[model samples]
Target chain A: MSMSPYSFRLAAQSLHREKWINLLSVLTIASGLLVISVALLVAYNVNAATGKLPEKFALTVYLNDNLGREKIDALIGALKKKQSVAQVRFIPKDEAMKELKTMLKNANYVFEGLDENPLPDSLEIRLKREAVSPEEVKKLTGDIGRMQGVAEIDYGEKFLAALHSVKSGVRTVGLSIITIIVAGIIFVCYSTVKILFYRRTEEIETFKLLGATRAFIRAPFIIEGGVIGMAGGLISLMSVYVLYYVVLTRMSSVVPLLSNILFPLDLFLLLPLSGLLLGVAGAVIAVGRLRY
Target chain B: MIQFSNVTKDYENQTALRDISFVIEKGEMAFITGPSGSGKTTLLKLIYSAEKPDRGNISVAGWDLDQLKASSIPYLRRNIGVVFQDFRLLGNRNVFDNVAMALRIRGMGEREIRTKVFETLKSVNLRHKSDSYPKGLSGGEQQRVVIARAMVADPTVLLADEPTGNLDPDTAESVMRTFKDINARGTTMLIATHNRELYRNTGRKVIRLEGGTLVGVGPG
Candidate 1:
């Protein structure tokens, strides 16, 4: 009819006799969760950093020395009228030569040999953040090329392609790894509870004889499984935090932008929350798979 | 009340019980006697709903065995008590908690649970052993704990298979006395055993079974 005294004792007895087995199972689940969470953290930070580059990087469009000042003004005016062009700075010939020399400081001697400034006047274009995709930048550059006396446009092509790949791949792989890890955690919990159930077959059979409902027999084992998972996850999460801090301290030179990307505080807050959620999910799966 | 109508049970590769039919009335004490593997335990297991009959119908406490819903099997068991030959006592819990289990499942409050558990343990003369774990007790004491648990729920129908089979003859007699007293209080009891001397002298109904078939129903 309902959960009675007999079933509770049986469930406790079942969990108690097989403590080590349950502990091992929970640890297995926690390790999988830790892998997934750490992967997510890295992916999130990389995506954020990569996402900032395109909108801020500029493209300089060169004009021929023969172009009239009035035509250059008209072309620059047309680009500024478009909502996508956030900034339009005209670089004069003398100033462009100076900027070129400063950028190539390592090879300043080569530029010093020239009698006159070989650089053309240019317009430095900065697009609105959302309008700076590689394809959109190409389209904007093509429009500028059709203008009178426009010589060339310069933005690094290989860098743009690499940035785009990093941005897209993070999202795709983040989801895939997290899914696989969570599924593995659930499987671990299910098998743990299933083994415990198998070990206590006689006890469960006795509960049935004493009139125990399915829920009555299931509640305590579920409680025990959830407790194991939560404890294991929390311990693993702590270990992961310590690892993150140690790594950040030891290897910050390898990635100068890592600190600017994701705060350690954010991971500290997320780890326990993720652990608790994983605990609940693992317990639910264990309960669902057990025969009533 | 329990009734078996042409019930047959088949395992994966063997017939455990074949074409068995019988009716046991309310408030009657009967013994199921047979040699080893003579379907004695199989019949008790059916009464406990461990498995459904492969063929025919068994009605117990107003439930049709074949028609019993998976969710409602516990309801039939609520009115019946089963004491296993192995005792099946939980080794992790002390005696008090073990006996209180029957009441706890029904959501009985702690104060009431303590009172009922104490009362049940007193009946088994195990009130002094209430704090002891099953592994710490003698075989007879552990079996008595099992008996206390079964009767703690106040089941109207009691099915004990080989309840005293594992105990010494002296201990076995005391167990029989416990059942006899329980039956005297108007509860129906069925005890399955192969001990001829134990049941032959008692003034109770005896259903003799051999080779999975009933040979005689005699009065002790």
Candidate 2:
């Protein structure tokens, strides 16, 4: 029924006529979207901050005391050839002892009575990014432990497990918060549009009398709901930008790690698109509930 | 054209129509007259598919109501026009928009809608009040706007339930004159009213119902 312009015009008029109700709906949608966006921001930063932990984990490969220089060179070459190894460095017994003395500081006196250096030569291995997960790290450590002239491989299982736990926890909490906020947004849009529908019952009755199809009767209300959602989404997105620039960036100065976090530009489109769909969904459901 | 075959309509409390059968040929005008609760309105509602008959068949403008799907009701309505007792004008809209509603529902273009609505308003002698809302118009003017809306789409059938019940004698006469002119243009018109003066000397067929049952039919 050439409903595009007519529906849009009607929706705009209705929105203006019922400014207070529409304003309340927009605010409700904005508040819900704001909470979701803030949670997204926090999740983004957490992912950025914790994203580096896996790369920092090193596998300390201790060599046998009787291993020869040639055998050690061959072992280092093999470790370097592996896809999971990012870098490797050999630590001779003397160099290891020196490092221990530096770490011990004045406690080096405890080693003074030893006839010779008891520390074994080791390879400080840094795994590639792909090996950051606990399972991958374990596999890499096990492979190295079976290598010739390697006495043991330690990749700090407890530390890797703790990192995995934290990442998953943040993700689970972020998803849960977003789910709740989305539900609330839909409910708000549904009830608001339903109330708006009731307010215009007379118009609807007249439309029916004029032989208007159901789609024709429904289009304007759906458009109104969508406008509400889009406005709310855009407003919330702007607020998020303001919070990031005014609050987050300033906080980053005090907390250096926050500097690396980014608000992906894609969300500007995504949030409004999501809002439009959610708004349309609520309107459809609400209109379908009407008897006529 | 309209036809009712053994039509029986029931409400929660009582029967609204009882085994009634009638037919009005195409391009004819008829009036339904009876007391307040005599099923005049219910008969009109049945013709428009606003309510389904409990045990009967109604066919209007060549579409059978007994087998009509709910989804097809709008299209069926598109072929007919209905005017309500209370004017049924949208208070929020101006007279021009009110008249244009039927054409708009048909998805007619704006330029054409504007032209047709203006032409119809002119026919109703309310062209000057195009921009005035229903609340600003007189009862007769509002009723004229409703008539304009009904006739704007040029439907073959028009049904009016007491189109002039709230109007003064002069205004009501004017409305009847408009209906006569419309009926002369080959559109079938069925009007339900209790105003004896309207049908007294009109020489139109009158169908009378008493307590949901047809009591008589003859020229008034």
True contacts kept of each: 0.67, 0.64
Best prediction by DockQ: 2
Interface RMSD of each: 2.7, 0.9
- Fnat of candidate 2 is 0.64
Q: Which number leads on TM-score? A: 2
Candidate 1 Cα deviation (angstroms), residue A207: 2.8
Q: With candidate 1 superimposed using the best TM-score fit, by how many Å does residue A54's alpha carbon deviate from the native?
A: 3.2
Q: Candidate 1: global Cα-lDDT?
A: 0.79
Q: lDDT of each structure?
A: 0.79, 0.88
State each model's TM-score restricted to chain B. 0.96, 0.98
Let me know the DockQ for model 1. 0.46
lDDT of 1 by residue, B166-216 (tens): 899999989888998899988898899988876787777887777777777
> What does candidate 1's lDDT look like per residue over A81-127, in tens digits?
97778999999999977777789999877875688878898999988
* Residue A196 shift from truth in candidate 2, angstroms: 0.9
